[model samples]
Target: MYTYTEFDEAFVRNRVAQFRGQVNRRLDGSLTEDEFKPLRLMNGLYLQLHAYMLRVAIPYGTLNSGQMRQLAYLADKWDKGYGHFTTRQNIQYNWPKLGDVPDMLDALADVGMHAIQTSGNTIRNVTADHFAGAAADEIEDPRPVAELLRQWSTDHPEFQFLPRKFKIAVTGSPTDRAVTKAHDIGLRMVRNAAGEPGFEVIVGGGLGRTPMIGKVINEFLPKADLLPYCEAIVATYNLLGRRDNKYKARIKITVHENGLDTFRELVDARFAEIRGEFSGVDQKILAGIEAQFAPPPLRQAETTSFEVRYAADPVFRSWADTNLSAHKSADHAIVTVSIKKQGQTPGDATSDQMRLLADIAATHAYDELRISHEQNVILPHVHKSDLPAIYDALASVELATANVGLVSDIIACPGMDYCALATARSIPVAQTIATRFDELKLEHEIGPLKIKISGCINACGHHHVGHIGILGLDRAGVENYQITLGGDGTETAVIGERTGPGFAYDEIVPAIERLIGAYLNIRQSDDETFIETYRRLGMEPFKDALYGESARSGRAHAA
Candidate 1:
């Protein structure tokens, strides 16, 4: 993790003081709600439907035991007893008082964390793969570049007031764990023919009312030109992007309105002009950042206990099979502590659970923790010898779920529950689906399925990229659930296709059940995952399953 210097500490403290003064002015009636809205947003505070929500950024999803403990403390002391981990790999407190947010910021600053640029139209948190340095197949660790971008974008004068919010993500592995395709600027670390590390820059990707997969603006941009190229892209968008309508204000909209070739030409021209301005300063910073992220020391340990437990205890075996990912080191495994336990909120972790996770990370996981974009906390480098102990500790806290990529492991947005922009409740729907699937005991059978639900078109839950995407809508004051099939957030990214008319809120779980059942029956073999089956056999079969023969005919006639 990148440690903050004395200058960084001073900068955060100054920002906190400024925000405190602004908050006092609002409380004293000097600034109305309208006048205070931008200020609060700049500080990552939002007034939700019933309470104030504070979003704290976890840059590149990396954290240490101390930072995790601070988050747990804040959850217990300042807000509700739990906090929600969001799809952006950030943590959100749904019920923070306006008066106490400054203290919250101060607490975050104490742990070398902050909520700055978490909201607003500026470049937000620079996210990377949760397994950035630990992934076995990574070309190189992406966090160094991610940190460089973070330092450059944070409080960049030219980009503070863009037409719409911009997001950037980086991934080092060939597999797209970061959902790079759905970001404003997605950088995939790739090696050129000459064996030089560079970025495959994709631009204009976004998901909201209008969803799009980013276009490859530059097939390969040298690592040294990263900052300048990124600046050029943002500058072009700043000048060309729409400001008249908030709906079309995103860079995705800009790219859609202008052809990719034209946009690429503009970006190339801009890059040419600004490329000289960087004189290798960003790369120098990146070198320093890379030194800070070197992998922790590995301890030699026996895995006989882990093997014995796996063989003797079916429960432990199930959890291990589901929760573990391959690590770069032979004796190490990446453990995902699933927050999506059955019937609970998808990403809500209690204060005690958070503290337990912190303890586990500190004691066993090299004191390193990662918040995954899938709403799970990751111990990126856990030795095989420590699996049983870690699992025991997690089980004692009721955190051992034995469901990581199964149907029960869903991604859900805080819909009508906390968000003012939501039209329907997403958490309840997610809970019901998970509980229903768990009751049927078919999660393992329905393997590697991603069911993402979003309350509205903002796509916070990334519904547009799930294998089974569910979008909640308001239909004449009633909740309507729309389903999209075959969507994926991987390297082969594709926006899901909608399956005819939507079901009511009550019918959604059953509809999902019917769809999965249909998939099981129609699939060629058990090995064929839901996404593979959807790809092998397109939307027609799923559509038939969702809307039966008569309903399909009625819909055809209506059309």
Candidate 2:
């Protein structure tokens, strides 16, 4: 949570004022819808299926209590009494009025936030690992570099109008939680032979209609060279990326068309050309940014209460087992508050829930919160001693779902429910799956399953990388759901393979059930997770479960 500097404050306020004027012009009919579209998109306003949506940037997915409270207030006042946390670690207000958007922007500026660079063919929000500073396996916190990129790329004149929207993600840990390999640029922190931590710069990674894992263009880049090296990559893409067709306009396609060797050569040449223009000023700034992320002071405290509760309360035990993660510090634990409760929307948090989260952050968790790419809120630094009380408070707000990596912890996009780009509905599908799994009582037993659903090919829900990837398509005026198996989003990233054909809306859930049931039978043991089982056995068993006569015979025999 870096507070805004004087320059940052002034810049955001000025942008809000400019947008206020643009909104007024549109209101007064001086600008038409087509004319206002691009201007408004630059500021993160989208014309969705039902109404205007405002996406607020959460840089590196970090938030302070005040900012979170303000978000709750905005949700209560402007739109409905809720906000949707997105896959990019941003929040979207889906029912914003055209005239009310300026006021919303001004409100966000009061707490060091805005919607700039969130949309419209530019470098979007710089996302990082949700458990960045706290993760036990981290080489170093990557948020400082993410913040530096945010400053460098925001309103950078050269990249403002690239061929398509660009995304960048950074992660400090060997385990990739930020979906780094699926961004335009993925920076994974690594230790060099000299034992100094640097970055493994990955280029041309993206997911949409075309999903591809990023390539390692640089085996190791010094910490000081991150910005310039990134600049070279984007600059190279801007020149060579296809603009003829929207589908082929992403950097992934550009890199595919040009080949990695040619792309690397071009980037290196550009890095040589523009490297001197940066000097050491960016590193100096990064030093200042690093100071802002100092770990919170934790006093020595007994974990007796937490241990006692874990033993006595099955409910609390279930939550602790699933929702908590290893922190670098013994006293602290990373708590992922699951917004995806059974039968609920995956990422939608009510104003009451948001306020409760903010209060808990302020009171116990060092006033810090994080939004995960999986669309869950994070209390990144809570003392283990305080787990019981925090769990109680979260339960009061219906957030203690205890299904962090379980089947119920699904990632889904707005889809046809609100997004005009969607060909099918994703919300109800997610809800049904979550609820169905819960009713079956097989969710926890299934073990570490990631089910991601996207309304369309844009992969907003990261369906391309889910262990069970569900993509909704419009097939001859019918809603057909396609399934992809063995997709992964971690260090070894892979796009899923599609099953033969799509299922009608009603058949999708049953198909998923059969697939999972088949997995349960085929797995070596309870410890064998869905992903490991898939890799070992391949997609044949799952395909048979979904579309084969043998699966039908098995089900009929069981009946």
After the best TM-score superposition of candidate 2, give how far the Cα of residue 456 lies from its true spot, in angstroms: 0.6
TM-scores of all predicted structures: 0.98, 0.99
- The positional error of residue 255 in candidate 2, measured at the CA in angstroms, is 0.8
Candidate 2: which stretches are off by over 4 Å?
553-559
Which window of ten consecutive residues has the lowest lDDT sum in model 2? 550-559
For every model shown, the clashing-pair count is 0, 0
What stretches of model 1 exceed 4 Å from their correct place? 549-559
lDDT of each model, Cα atoms only?
0.93, 0.93
Candidate 1: what lDDT?
Answer: 0.93
How do the residues 229-292 of candidate 1 rate in per-residue lDDT, one tens digit apiece?
Answer: 9999999999999999999999999998998999999999999998888888777888888899
Q: How close is candidate 1 to the true structure, as a TM-score?
A: 0.98
Clashes of 1: 0
